[model samples]
Target chain A: MKYSGIKVLWEGLRGNMGWKPLWRNPDPKKSYDIIIVGGGGHGLATAYYLAEKFKITNIAVVEKGWLGSGNIGRNTTIIRSNYLLPQNQPFYELSLKLWENLEQELNYNSMVSQRGVLNIFHSDNQRDAFVRRGNAMLMSGADASLLGVNDLKKMVPFLDFQNSRFPIKGGLWQPRGGTVRHDAVAWGYAKEADSRGVDIIENCEATNFLVKNGRCYGIETTKGVIKSKKVGVCVAGSSSQVMGKIGINLPIESHVLQAFVSEGLKPVIPGVITFGAGHFYVSQSNKGGLVFGGDIDGYNSYAQRGNLPVIEDVCEGGVALMPMVGRARLLRIWGGIMDMSMDGSPIIDKTNIKNLYFNGGWCYGGFKATPASGFCYAHLLATGTSHHDAKDFLFNRFEKGRLIDEKGQGNQPNLH
Target chain B: MLIDHPLLGLRDSSEFIYMGDAKLLNRPNWKSKNSKTKFIDYGYLRKNPGGVHKELWYHEQGDRSWLVVTRNTVTHEILKVELARYLKRKENAK
Candidate 1:
C-alpha cells in the first residue's frame, strides 16, 4: 500500500486497520536469472535497482536470517561524502545524492535526514587535511563548508572547547549529510523490490556455489539447490566465510565494531559530530537518544559482542569531547561484524569464477554507501561493465598497486 | 580480555596493541628476482587460522616490549608469549 498523509488520515478514520505487511514472505523459487546472497540493505537495494533500472525482475535475494539483521540495523545511522581520495569522493557523493531523494523514490519513510555532518579538527594539521577533503567534496559537486570555532560553538555549545590537551580548532561541515532510520531502509528496499516482482526469500542461506567448470551455474542453500544464471555475494561481515566456501580468500577481515545508545534525553545534538582527536562520532536519534560509535575491537573475530575495554575507551572519548554525555546514564550497546578491506575501500568486482560477483569490504562506510553500492552492483550484474562511479572498486586493486587508501592508513584492515 | 605476559604477568589486552601474524617479521630478501611476488604474498596474504596462531603484540603501557603471542583466534586463549627481540636474537644465533 502507498503511504501518504491522505492514507494515514483514511486509515485513522477506519480504526487504522488498512496497514499491510511491508514485504511479502515468499518461498524460494527453483531457479532465477540472478540470485543475490545476503538480504541486507545492499542486497535489497541491488534487487530493487535491477528490477527498476535494468528491468531484470527475475531476481531472488536469499538471506540466512530475517532482513535488516546485519550491519544495516546496527549502525550509528550517519551518512556523508566528505572524502579526499579521487577514487572514493565521486562514489560517495553519488550515494549522498541518492539519499537526498530516497524516501520519494522508494515510497517509504526511510527518514533520510540531511541535518549535516561535522568533522571537528583539534589541531592545525587536521584542519588542513579537512580543508583538502572539503575541497575534494566540492570538486565532486557535493556541498561542503569549513566552519570555524565560533560557528561550531554556536551550533553545538555542549562541546568542551577549552580542553587543554585537545582544543577545538575548526571543523569541515557537509550540509547534505545526516542520519536515516537504518532498518527502515531495508524494509523500504525490500518492499520496492518485491513490488517489482523480485522474491525476497528469508531464512534461506546460500551454503555453497555449484561451480562445475567455474561458470557458477547455481547455489546450494539451506532450503535447496537453486539454479541461477548469475549469483552476487553481498554479505557484509560474512564475506570471507561465504566466498571462502569456493576457495576465494578475500583481503577482508571481520572485526566487531560496537555502537552505543544512551537513555532518552532532550534534543541536544543538531547533527552528527565526530571528535577528531579520537575515533568517536555521535548523533542524536529522533527518539532523543544519543547514538554513537568508535573504532573496531582491533582483533579479527566474527562475534557480535565487544569487550569492556573498548566500551570504556569509547566512553572516554565521548566524555572528553562533551563532558555532559558522561552524566547521561548508559542505556545499551551492540556490535556488528565489519568486513574491513586492506586499503580502507570497498571491492565490487567479479571474482575469478565466471558469472559470480562480490560486493563487500565496506569497513565503517557501508551504511552510507547502501544506495550507490546497490546501484553500481546492479549495473554491473545487468551489464557486464563497472559503473562509472564505482570503477576504482576493482577486486585486484591491491595486487595492481592501485589501492584506494582513503584514510592513508596503509594496508591495515583494522585501522580502516 | 587479559593476556598473561611472561614478564609482566596478567595485563589487560587494552594495554597492548595488536598486530597480525608474527610472520611479518620474517622479511623476504628484496634482492631476489621474485621479490615482488614474495612481498605481495607477505604484505597482503595471511593464514588467519581459526585455531592457535602466532601474532605480534606490543606492551605499550607496561614493559614497552614487542611480544610474539601464540593465541587462538576462535577462543582468544593465549598459548605462549615471548619478547620479539629475544626471539629475533635466537633466530640470528640459529
Candidate 2:
C-alpha cells in the first residue's frame, strides 16, 4: 500500500495495470495537483523535485508510455560541468554534484560512474578555446585539468596515439564527469517520487491543456481531463505540440540523435572519451557494452530509427580513436527525439501561462542536466521566482535576443 | 548550402585542388603523442563565420563546415592563398 515512486514505476513497467491500459488508457479522466506531460527524465525529475522538495504530493506525472522509455533512456548519459558560458556552468555543476550523491539520495541504484571525462584537443585554436573553458570551470568551483598528449596517453593507454588522422593531443579532463545508467535514473526518480505521494501515471498521454482565463487549470489527456491548479510541461521533444494547446509556440526544433551499443566485451574504455575534433563519445556500460553516440541526424524526423550516415560517421570516429572497437560487433543502434532549442541549452521556467512551467530543450545533454533542472524548477515553484542560478535560461531569451549561444556556432547541433 | 568546416573552427570554400591528410595544428612540446590532422582546400568561401580563415584549413576540429580559398583553376594549385588577407587592415574610426 506504500506506493512509492520506485514502487509505482516498477508497477507501471511490469504492467501492474496491464499492457493495454499502460499504452492506451482509452478513457483518461482525472484531476490532481500538477499534471506533468512526458514521463522522460525532465518530467519524472520535475515530479520528484516537486514532491520531495516542495512537499507538493498531489502531482501527477502522466507519460505517453513507460517512464524513461523516451529520450531520457536514450541519451549518452554523460555528466559534466565544462560549459564555457557562466549561465550554464553553475546549473550543470549542481547536476554533477547531485549525480555524485544520486545513488544514496534516491535510495536507488543508478550506477552513476564518475570515472572521468576527456575532451581531446586536435588544434591550437581548439586548445585555446578549451583552455578558456577549463578556466571558466575552475572559476565556477568545478574541476577541469588541461592535459598534454603524455597525460592523455597515460590516462588512456590503449588509445592509438601513434597512427591516427587526428593524432593524440592534450585534453580537458573533468575527474567527475562520467556516465550513469540512463534507464535506472528515470526509474529511480519515478519510484522515489511515487513513494513520496506523487502520482506516476504511465500510458496516460497529455493530449491538451485546459486553460481558463489564460491560465492552465488542468490537462486533457487520453485518460480524460486531469484538473490541477498548476501544470508543468516537462515534455522535451513534443514541447511544441504541448505548448501549442496553450497558444505558446516554443522556438524549439525536433531533431533526431542516435546512439549505439556494441556487444559486451572486456571493458576497454575506462571513462568517457569525447573527440573534441569529432562527433563521437564512448562509455562502457556496467554491463560491458560500449554505449556511444554523436552529432544529430543532420535532418529532422520524428521517426525513432536512425540512418546509415550517422552510424557510419559514429563508427568511423570510434575507430579513429580506438581501433580495437572496430572488431566489436554493434549489438544494436537506436535513435531518440531531442527538443533542440535555437541555442544548445535548456529552458526551465514559468511559461507565459501563469502557472504552467517548463523544463525542456535539453538537446543531447539531458541526462546530465536532469538533477539540476529539477532542483532549479522546484526552487522556482517553491519561491515564486526564478532561481538566481538559472536566470540566463529564461524562456523569453529568444525574443529578448539574449540567447546564451555557448558554442557560438549559431546552430542547435553545436549546442551539445 | 556552403557551411563551415565540421571540426575546424574556420572556413574556406574552393574546389579542393588536392586532398591532403589532416594534421593537428597544436601539440605541447612536453608531450610525445602524435598530433595529426587533415583538411581540404576548396577554391570557394565556406561560410564559417566563427572560424579561422586560411587558404588551407586542416580540420583539426570536427563539425563539418565550409572552407574557401583562391585555387589556380588551370594549375590545380592546392597551396593557393586567400584573398581576404588584404581585408585584415583594421577598420578606421570614422
Candidate 3:
C-alpha cells in the first residue's frame, strides 16, 4: 500500500550499484547506421521518431544504463502548454498536441489523463501576469480558460478559498494538460522502436567519437567500436559529460530534482494543481498516491540523492495547499538529475560538427515533450532541419545571445 | 501580514486589490452566461496564505478573485507580482 522506498527496491531489481547506471548493455558491439547516446526519455524518443517518422531503421540507441532509469523515471509527470513566452509557446503547444494522440500514435497505453491543470494567482500582480499568459494562450490557439474562485470552488471544494494569507484570486486553467505514466512513455517508445528494427543496445556506453578528417563517422563505446554514418546525442542529464568527449562545451548545469509520493489515499485530487506562489506541482496517481515535486537542488550535483532544503520547501507547499495530505504520510522520495540549461526549454538541433546531432536540455518538461522532441530530432537528423518549430533551441542560440529563457529567469535554472 | 481567518491560520497574506471596478476572468468557450462575471471580492486585505509571498492579492484579470499574499516578515514586497504594471515598473527600474 506504499511506494516510499521504491528507489531501493528498483536498484535491487536492476542490480544497480552506487553511481553506476542500470539497464546498460555493458557488452555491445558498436557498429550500426546511427548511434544514439544516453537511453533516457530524450534518447529513446529520438530512436522512436527516427524509426517511426523518418523511416530510418538502421539505428542503435546506445544506452549506458537501462531505459528510463535516468531523469525520465524521476519527474512528477505534469504536462501543460500554459507558457507566456512566444519562443516556448508554440513548441510546448506542439508537445501537447503529441500527448493528445500519443495512445493512438504509439499504440501503447501511457495512461495519459487529461485531468486539467491550474495555475493559481495569489496577488494582483500575479493575476495580471496570468492575464498576459492567458491572452497569449488564446492568441496561440491553445485551450486555456481563466477560472474564477467560484469555478474553482465548484471544481475543488476542499480548497481554502478565503482564509489564507495568499487568497485564491483565480487560476489559469488548461483543460488538456495533465499527467501520464513517465516510465511507460519511455518503455512505450523503446518497445515500439525495438520492434521496428532499432537496435536498442542497452548497457553500451559511448565513450568517444571516432572523427575522421574533422567529421564524425562512428563511436567508440565501452563495449566495442560501432560504425555509424550519423550519431545523435540524446543523453538528457549526463549530456555535458557525453558531449565533452567530442570537445563541445554546453551551457548545461546538471541539477538534481526530487519527487515525492504520498501514501495511497482514495483519490482526493481529481486533477493536477501547481502552486503559482511556489515551485510545487502535484497530481494524484491512478494507484491513489499523491505525486509531487518542486525546484531543482540549486547547485550542480551528479549524486542522485538530493539535499534537505528542497524537500522541506516542497513539503511546505503541499501542507499549505492540501492540509489533509499532512496526515497521509510520505511514502517515498527519489531524485533524478536534469541537464537544466541556462534556459528552461530544451535544445533540439545539429551541432556545428557535421553528422553529430544533439537533443538535450529538457529542464523538467522532458516527459511531456518526449514524442514531439523525438519526432523533431529525427527530422533534424534525416533532413538536417527541424520538423515543427525547434530551430530557436539550437546550441548556437547560446553563442548568438538568443537564449529561450523560460520562467523568465534568464538562462539560469537556479534563478528559476 | 497576520490576519485571522476561519481556514487560513495566523500568517495569511493577500495578493492584489481591485480598488476600481473590474471584470472576472471567464472561460470563453463555455456555453453558460455565468462563464465570465461569476464572483465578487470582499474589498479588504487579508494575509495571502499562499506559501511564497505575504501580501494582499486581487484577481482583476476579468475575475473578481481575492488572495492573501504571504510575504517576507521584514521586506513587505509581494513575493510574486502578477500585475504587469507593478512588475514592469520594478523590472524597468532595474
Best model per TM-score: 1
Q: Report per-candidate DockQ.
A: 0.44, 0.02, 0.02
The residue-level lDDT of candidate 3 at A413 comes to 53
The candidates, ranked best first by DockQ, are 1, 2, 3
Runs in model 2 lying further than 4 Å from the true structure: A1-30, A411-416, B1-94
Tens-digit lDDT string for candidate 1 (A1-416): 69999999999999989899978898888899999999999999999999999999999999999998999989999999988998899999999989988999999999999999999999999998889888899999999999999999899998999999999998999989999999999999999999999999999999999998879989999999999999999998888789888887777777889999999999999999999999899999999999999989998776688889889889999999999998998799998888888888999999999999999999978999999999999999999799999998997787899989987888878888
**TM-score of every prediction relative to native:** 0.95, 0.76, 0.75
Between candidates 1 and 3, name the one with more favorable TM-score. 1
Estimate, for each residue in B1-94, the C-alpha lDDT of model 2 and write its tens digit: 1223333423432212212111112112433333111111111102211112233332323332223343322222334332222323222222
lDDT, candidate 1, B1-94, per-residue tens: 7888888798999998888778889999999989987888788766555467788888988889998988776666778888899999999999
lDDT tens digits, residues B1-93, model 3?
Answer: 333322333332222232211111221345556533221111111111112333334544324434443333223333433443454467568
lDDT of 2 by residue, A46-144 (tens): 778888878887778788887678887778788888898998998888889988998887877888889999988887888999999999999999999
TM-score of chain A considered alone, across all candidate predictions: 0.99, 0.91, 0.91
lDDT of each: 0.91, 0.71, 0.71
Share of the reference A-B contacts seen in candidate 2: 0.00
